[model samples]
Target: MDKEDLKKLVQKIISNHQIGVLSSVENSKPHVRYMTFFMKDFILYTPTKKNTEKIEEIKNNPHVAALLGYVEKGSNDEYVEVTGICSISEDKDLKEEFWNDSFHNWFNGADDPNYVLMEIKPEAARILNSEHMKTMEITL
Candidate 1:
């Protein structure tokens, strides 16, 4: 597929999937956790708590990676590997845009001080699928 097609495929995968594994580094070791993500084009956003370990990890090491769109029982399972730099933000508009009741388990509401947004600006990505057992790079 061409770059444009790859971009569309990546966007479609992200749009179809809400949960992804976000990988970060801490104390020279790697840590990964499943997170609910909101994506706008190639940029991804995930809400997190201020006191979470991932917050500190991102603070120390801004580089991060994520895996999205995988299904255990599917033969044609396709996934995207996104590598990017993460930056934390407390933008109210963004918070309101991505907030949902499910997050209440972690924060009081959209205005909760503990709630923050982790923005991943993808520098590069690779879309993998079972069809050719190959990966295609999506140009950012």
Candidate 2:
């Protein structure tokens, strides 16, 4: 696919997916975990607590890889593999934007001091589809 078309497909896949695997280097090894994600202008954000282990890991190694949009549709499903620089955000507006009542399970609320947003600014990405088996690099 052309760059524009590949971008559309990547955006479509990301927009339809919310949960994914985010990996960070910890102790010189890769640590992967499921995370809930939202994106704005191709920048991914995941809500987390300031005290979480992942926060420290990201701090030590800003490089991260996230797998999004594989929702159990077998070989037909398309997913985006994103490699990005991760940073922690404590901005009030962003916190409110990503806030949800269900988050009370992990946080007191959006206003909680421990609540934070993990922002992933993609340096590069690839659209992976089983049927197509095409790996298209995207410059974000």
Candidate 3:
């Protein structure tokens, strides 16, 4: 597919999926966990507590990877693998913008000092659709 087509497909995949596996490196090994993600265009954001191990991992190594878009157990499943740089943001406006009631379980509220946002700026991506049987690469 063309670049525009590929971008549309990637956007669709991201829009349809809410949770993804975010992988970060720690002590030269890979550590991954499922995180609830929010997207604005191509950039993705995931909220987490300040004391989490992933926070430290990102601090030590900003390079990260993520996987999104898994629909079901079938041959037609499509997913996107994203490689990017991650950074922590504590901006109150940003926190309020992405805040949801669900986050209260882990955070006291949007103003909670422990609450922070992990921002992933996509550097490259690979989209795999079982039906297509080919991987499409995207650079951002």
Candidate 4:
């Protein structure tokens, strides 16, 4: 696939998916966990608590990776893998923007001081399918 097709593929997967695996370097090893994400203009955001271990790991190392677009039982094997540079953000407007009713389970509110967003700017991305022969990548 060409760059434009790859971009469209990325948009289709990420825009349709919300849950993904986010990884950060911890003690020279990869530390990964499930996170709810938001995408806009190809940028990724994952809301998290400021004091979480992932925050410290990201602070010590800004590079991260994420996997999105997979579902149970491998029914939908197609997915997007992203390697990106991550930074922490506490912008109130963003907090408000990313907030949703479901977040109430983990946060007191969007204004909660512990709440923060991890902004990930993709350096590289690829779409893969375990059940298909299709795969493509692009650098940004």
Which portions of model 1 show Cα errors greater than 4 Å? 130-132
22-44 per-residue lDDT for model 2 (tens digits): 99999999999999998887789
Candidate 4 residue-wise lDDT, 1-140, digit = tens = 67877877787888788899998999999998999988877889999988989999988999999999978666657899999999999989988999998998889999999999999999999888735566777999
* Residue-wise C-alpha lDDT for candidate 3, range 1-140, written one tens digit per residue: 88888878887888799799999999999998999887777788999999999999998999999999987984778998889999998989889989999998999999999999999999988999746899899898
Residue 80 of model 2: what lDDT?
89
Q: Is 1 or 2 the stronger prediction by TM-score?
A: 1
Worst lDDT window (10 residues) for model 2?
Answer: 127-136
Residue 12 CA displacement from its true place in model 1, Å: 0.7
TM-score of each: 0.93, 0.92, 0.93, 0.91
Which stretches of model 3 miss by more than 4 angstroms? none
Q: After superposition, how far is residue 57 of candidate 3 from its true place, in Å?
A: 0.6
68: Cα error in model 4, Å: 0.7
Model 1 quality (TM-score): 0.93
Which structure is stronger by TM-score: 2 or 4? 2
Which candidate, 1 or 4, would have the higher TM-score against the true structure?
1
lDDT accuracy of residue 49 in candidate 2: 84
